[model samples]
Target: MFRISPFIFILIFLTACTLPFNQPILTEGATVPRPQNAATAPVEEQTEPPTAIPDTQTQPTDIQNDTTNGATTDNLEELANTTPADRDQVALVEALTGNDLPEFARTEPLDVQVGDTETFWVSDILNDSNYEVDARLRYAGPHVLMYFETAVDDQIRQEDIDRAAQEFEERIYPRNRALFGEELSPGVDGDTRLTILNITLQGAGGYFSSADSVVQEVNRFSNEREMFVVGLNSFPVGESSYGSVLAHEFQHMIHWHEQRRGPAWFNEGLSTLAEDLNDFGDDNTTILHIQNPDIQLTTWSNNAAQTGQHYGTSQLFMRYVYEQYAQDGGLAQLIQDDAGNNLAAFATMAQQTRPDINSFADIVADWAVANLVNNPSIDDGRYAYSLLPETTTPVDLELNTINDINQFGADYLTLPTGTTTLTFDGSDTVSLTGATPNSGQYAWWSNRGDDSVSTLTRSFDLRDLTQATLQFSLWHEIEYNWDYGYVAVSTDSGETWTTLEGQTTTKEDPQGNNAGTYGLTGISGKPGIETDQGEVGQWIEEQMDLTPFVGQEIQVRFWLIQDDAYNANGMLIDDVRIPELDYVDDFEEADESWEGQGFVRTTGTLPQQWTLRLVKEVGSETIVESVETNEAGQANISVNDGETGVLVVVASTPYTTQTATYTIQSETR
Candidate 1:
């Protein structure tokens, strides 16, 4: 294992731990770097556009002609003599104009001719704290990530970082579709490029990703850009409810569509509205249930309430006013009504929405009162109280050699006896990429002798077997001659065998029916078994029900008797196993006594509650003891279940808690 920083290693280890069982199981593009790591949910909504083009008045352009024959030489001389300090100022101007800057001191030189690219006076290097960068959109070529750094430390909060991302997605590039309604290209230079790094909360100000995992943040004046920042300090770590913080910032980008900029109320209120309210007639409002401080809904923040509530309630207040007063155009209309103005007129317009502006204040007061008994539970669809019984350690059975059975691989299994090694390879087709070789052999074979028996005994347990499965492998070349294989079971070691299964395959004529004579079959052929090249690397998976064979200790054996030498060439085996229930049966195995009966059973409600039916065969019966389950979804108990005449349990509410009893049932016939 490579050494990683504490943060990186922790994340990596968690990733591996949580991969085996993922909540809301992910599909496609999901990577599990380690266990115990929660999988990230896919972005359900775009939330915001990629980037917002600055809305500014256009300026007329003027150009001077280079009339002199020596003008080109003059320009080169002037450019070469420019000082580094002069170039910095020029670069700053270029940034504002969204134009490329020329090569200057403190920067690498550009080889292209001056005519191909524009120039700007470079300014001070932008640092991390003072500014932020929206590096999510720019993923291609050199200098794709814009830098925004300040001298101030601890300026970049996690929430601010997340908000910046959401705003860019919802405001700028709405989706992968081009402005002209064309599909975006796959690469970064293309329109629909995606940023590898999602969000960072490190010491750096600007964000840049050289690859999917690495990021670099720097604080320099020259790095300053119009980057968005979010503040995550308002919420607790691991608490997902504060997702509205993202929605709030996203509205900033959306509001920019109507008004280029505005006061904190208009921007903040509208952004807040994205959390609890929406006027677009779309259900884009964030869906979150807040607990505590439940007052009549009003625009007020509670210290005790979670972070999401503060921002969400703020947005809800703004939305309530907009919906009540403005019907025709609403907020959108109000923004368009302003000729590049601020929220000063908002108070007046808000009067139309709420005649009693003070009503919201009362609502907030009511919320404070309601906070006393406001403890509500929440379900976010991704978690549950008790999922499944946790397995502390893996099953103790020796996977390398089950019951002395040895030699198994993805494609082939071999059992060595005498001079020849019997091989059964499952030419199973591959479903997952890079999992196992699809063309190789897969099999499990054992030739271990039981110390107490003379004949070779092969105990087999197969769970899923089905009809139409004639034990065929795709790698076997010969046509269907599969009738030669036979399956048998023996009770007393392998002394006597009872034929249980057999399969046969035939080569039918292309037209369907068998040829007129025996060997004259041009299309139809008799069922025969073959082990040619074709059937060596294929596997057949089937579902079999083995309810009839219980109690009787059985040993299974498969013999591929060859009718023709060609039938002895290839064979593949797969999904080959006799499955046993969670509880092992008592038969020849010693110490099959009642091991202090495990008093755990399943129970449900009246109509669906499980009834425990105990049947006595011989000997005596004893009711040992009973225990109650303390865990959630555990059960309580009742002594009887009507006609079943055994132990019964009344199902509990919330479908929780169960109880079980240990009882020994026997009879003297």
Candidate 2:
């Protein structure tokens, strides 16, 4: 397992495709077998994070962006430099300005047609305010208002506008509207026609601003127009992917109106799907993802290196979900569901469409299987890609110590060639050692994703114990007062629950004033965890007394809860044991150290081999004999004539999922 850079800053802002989405306010939870104590040392942000595996095979060049397709490529170089901070600040300010709605710049609609010219406030590539433009409406359909930046209108060909308008009115608008639901129509911009301001966007092909849908009498902040800011340079009319960009940006508009709470990954996924649905084109980012599948699916950042993977993988997952489970309008259901984000949104969509699918994990499990083994011919394409061509080249390596492979990501490893037998033992040879506490990362679950819940649980019969003390090595980098990580117990089969406090449990006052503790169980930590510097504090040996329920059978769970706003690696637990019950779990052995989502140390070869080869395991044929492993994580892998043994280690959670594997790989002799 290769160690990607430890620094992954999540952008938790509102922006369209190509712009960094909501960044991690503070996170990931890994099932560390045992993390020795380390302190959170102050550090500066890295220039960029990770070991980006390069593509060995030649990637098919994108034909959509060539000069031949009418796309202006000179300014495409300017795309990556445009930061989302301006849009993020605008959103933050708007949120803070809650209920302070101002009068609309215009109470009525723009009574204009295709040739009408209008002066509109537009942001430059940098989202600077003073870049207003007078734009002529080129395409005024019943549903769309395609405006050309008058400055560049003469340069753009009339044929390109006709081609783009035809797609928008006939293909993009109706198709997306039917699939993703409607954008805010007759909006505060006083227009029924959704505006598509085709300016030369800073670096993005286009972006949707909530500010455009907003209004104020004097404040120049809001565009006070229902519009999407598109770049003339990125998607010159008549370009192949232009309709896709339109479809993509249109989705952000509708999504803003509908499921505003949806996570960036989910929203971006749907937006890309909008492109696919409109018949514009498939997502071009797949090559980036196949080259580096270890990019965390749910976690997002502004880095140019990983941004393509983020979009590519997002489309890959969402498209899989849509293809496999979304039978009766599931995509629409997902966009309409306001309560769900990430896997939660899919869970809701699945429940409504396909009731048999209990959790998103089931889908993820199938999808993971599909990623490694994509055979559309098998099981009705359940374990295959109906849309994407599988282009994974699993990183081949000897068994090395893999520490923090980000969640909802997978690391495919090819065993060294010329090996006859392979063995894996989960004890010392194989274990998920969570990120080094207080050091490179916060805890075992290092850099947890926003709105994620990672849990480690076990059921225990405590009737024999007179007194029991729960003990564990715990470290957390939770957002103070806003997000939480704690130990909770449930006696009624998880129907009801009670939180057990520990040494670090403190009432966090989100406000500066010492407000009532209320239901908020502040930051769970020792005195020094909250340092002036943002690095996580040291790991603490914690205990929560369970003596009160000594006579009953109980279920105990270690939990981490994060909100959508900020970033914080929720919590990490290691060496958990109860004194009276004489039960202990070091997470070293391939057994039930604890039974839950965060970490599973497996026995034999089920977990390891599942992620390894044997792409499809259905009906009578075992792709290859299962490699046998002992109490120690040792696997006996049989290498064929020229084929390499590819081992994949993956874990999925409710909202946030990630890939983590052992440092221990089969040493080919």
Candidate 3:
């Protein structure tokens, strides 16, 4: 159900490209803010080799002066004496490249140091070997650093980086801390620094890499490090767009440090959620998945065709959890719990928040249904939150009564008048002579003490026809005195109605005989009314003439009414036909009175001959009927009476084959 619209995707993609500062931002060296009672433990240092060191041409000895040694008491006093801006700039540089560098950066001596006039440089840190200075920035705030590539400094101005840093420090960092209950700071190993480098990361708009992975090639990059690096796509994405990616990757960094990264779905979902929390707006791709419930959420592969759906569904599922189950810091608790598995972590969180939920599968099933109906009040608000856009609506009935009754096994339709509850008895519990004609696979039984009006109407212009005949097969056992079914018509939709005369009702006697009685017999006087004198095992075919209303735009309706108690086997109507117009029948619900008849319409500029074949399954019998459509594109075909069997109408053309099936009951009367 994930409906993917390329236009919407492109629109969102362009919006992300235009709004750079909307990305989530993290301040360097932010720490998880813990409760007063909860002591903040220091992150244990890991003595592992660097994951991948930058391929730099020069040695990292150019700026190797110890930061603590350089800032003497007199020098500190001088620094304090300077302007506020200069003091803040010096403080930030010290925080980023001081004696305690990120754990990964500490593996090798880093040529990172503050220069005169408050400027700092990390030599060849961006892995851009072509440039001697990989990243250079001027400190803009106590926790913010502004970087602009020297190669594109003319195009990428200092103001852009400063704006990005301001947004990150002001908007993104505090928001994340509020939701995550932690500050974005270095991990326990202290091998890396929280730094945002504006450079082209290979193959992605932005990416987060642990310091350990960046420093040297390690067997695996463990997230249990003090600091990580954020690489933003450095193509002048503006501050908002830049902040969006930062928010996304920052969640990754946080998840790495606070909780062991689970699956790609969880990591991506949380990161995307981070973007939303920072007010970057919901990821449009995720909206697609939220609208479509049929998409599988768990299995995700990078190269799979459904990669976008995977990302979207993951984000939506997490959003649902965050909104429905974990509004009160449960998300943060789950992440910190680090249950070691995604399902286990989710289950634990659900148990603490939604104790009623038994398992993750329950949540999924409820969530899937919610994605369709979205009514929170349903089922005690279990699947209540509406994360998807307002564009989503409830699912329509798969098969409407007018289209295919066999699929529904009953005459079910949304009536214009009001609601009607018609229950079908498909178990063959009530029968005649051991044959369940009235109780075939499908038969609607009226409810006792129920007085309601159920009508099925079809509208069409009959101006072109000289004569119109209404014919149908019926099996009924309504309360003789109070309940009845009638055939009616209207020219003004359902505003007014006129009943057709000569209608009759039939019911099977206790001895399996068709007992016919006049009820509201239509014009033709119930021509084929079976009179076996028992429970009408043999179905009766009736006809009504609509010749008077032939030249007008008219609507025909079948009304079945029941009142008071003592309801019997109600009715089974099938193979209803208005020749030259349409035919509707449910093979599973038909009785012996059903006739193999239907209409086939073909459209072409020229008249075309077509074949209509009626195949009976009992004897493997095939009856082929041929007809030609007029210039107006209409063909009506009627097959004569056939032996009891499954009857199928195959309308064939050179290019198409359309088939409809019905069941003809054995005539026992």
Q: Best-fitting candidate, measured by lDDT?
A: 2
Span of ten consecutive residues with least summed lDDT in model 2:
28-37
| lDDT for residue 535 in candidate 2, whole number 0-100 | 38
Candidate 2 achieves a global lDDT of 0.51
TM-score of each: 0.22, 0.56, 0.40
Candidate models: Cα lDDT each: 0.24, 0.51, 0.39
Q: What overall lDDT, based on C-alpha atoms, would model 1 receive against the true structure?
A: 0.24
Model 3 agreement with the true structure over 1-669: per-residue lDDT tens digits: 011123323433445333222111111111110000000122322223122211221211111111122111112122112211111111221221232223243443223443212122221211211122344554335544454444444566556666777787888876776666553353333423455555433223444443223222110122233322333433244745557667776666566546533334455667777877787766566555645434445433222233455566767777778887777477677667642233445666777766855545445544544454456654456545644664333232222222211110111111111222221111111111111222123322221112223345567678888877777665444433234455667776555555554334332111101101213211112223221122232355656667778889887765544321112234445556677566554444324432111111101011111122222222443222223334222333232333321111111111111111222122122
lDDT of 2 by residue, 1-669 (tens): 000111211221123234422221111000000001011121232222112211222221221111111211112112112111111212222222222334355667877887889887653322212356788988777777778888888788877887787878888777777887888778776678787788765434566655456553222334667777666665567777567677777877777666544555676777777777777555556656777777777655433345557777778888788777674267777766542343555666656655655555556655765777676665445667656666577665555565445555666656666644555433222112222322221123422443344566678898887878787766554544334566767777765456664555544322211111111122233332321133333455667778777889998876554433233434555567676677766554435435555322221111221223333232443243223344334555556545545565443322232233456545445
Expressed as tens digits, the lDDT of each residue in 1-669 for candidate 1 is 000112322333345333221111111001101111001111122222112211221221221111112111112122222211111222222321233433222222223321132111111111101222333221122211212222221344545444544543554334211111211122212222232222332311112111111101110122212122222223222233233333333344334333432322234445444443322221111122122112212111111122233233334344444444443346665555431122224445655644433322222222221121121221111111111112111122111231211010001111121222111111111111011111122221111000000011245343432211112111121223111222445566554444332112222222111111011100011112222211222222222223344455556443222110011112222233343433322111212231111110111111111111111111233221122333222333222211111121112111111111121222211
lDDT of 1 at 400: 26
